[model samples]
Target: MTAKAHADAILNLLRTAPGTPLTVLDGSVPNGTVAPYVLVYFADEDPELPDSRPLDGQSQRYVVRAYVHSVAGNGAMARAVGDRVRSALLDAVPTVAGRVCWPIRREEGRPPERDESTGTVVMDRVDVYRLESVPA
Candidate 1:
């Protein structure tokens, strides 16, 4: 599947999740928008090959950023939002458009930090998955 499809799948998962505060979107949130919210963006895609043979599948990577604003700017709320995002997506093998995206993994994550310009706390998480499109 394409990066946009991967992002959309993750966004849909988060949107339907119970008690999740993330406002998952296909793109970045509007300027001056307040938190708590999340934006799902396509990062990159690489070919997955076990041998030197022609490519059979793809490894897609997506970045999910959770944001929250606080007067203290302590990032506590932002971290909480990040935790929710992680809970919803980490280790999930969600399906998109009837295709299975398996072996989804949390590649990396960043701790919440204060954005000087927006004065909001933000946390970034990266998720990678192997989408097997062809026989092995």
Candidate 2:
């Protein structure tokens, strides 16, 4: 799947998840807006070395970032949102465009912190997936 497709899959997954409080954005939130939300976007992709075994499909390292924010300036809420995101995405092999995206995994996550400029608490998490599809 393409990067856009990957991001869309993630956004859709989070949007439909149960009991998630914040709004989910494809990339960025609107300027001058200060609502609790999470931004999902494609970060980067890298190619993995081809394996020797047959059926060793092309592997790619795809990075997807989730940015959680809360206007209440409550770090706990931000962290809770991040935790929900992590629970939904970790080890998930979500299908995209009718194809199974395999071996998706969470890489790392950051704790909530205050954004000095906006005064909103924010939490960031990064996930890495090994997309078996050939890189475009």
Candidate 2 residue lDDT tens string, 1-136: 4667777777777777778455777667788655456765566554454552236554443444443332334667666666677666666666666444554566555555556665654444333333333333
**Candidate 2's error at 75, in angstroms?**
1.3
Which stretches of model 2 miss by more than 4 angstroms?
52-72, 119-136
Clashing pairs in 2: none
Q: Work out how many backbone clashes candidate 1 has.
A: 0
In model 1, which regions exceed 4 Å deviation? 51-73, 119-136
Q: What digit string (tens of lDDT, one per residue) describes model 1 on residues 71-113?
A: 2234676666666766776667676554545645565566655
Which residue pairs clash within candidate 1? none
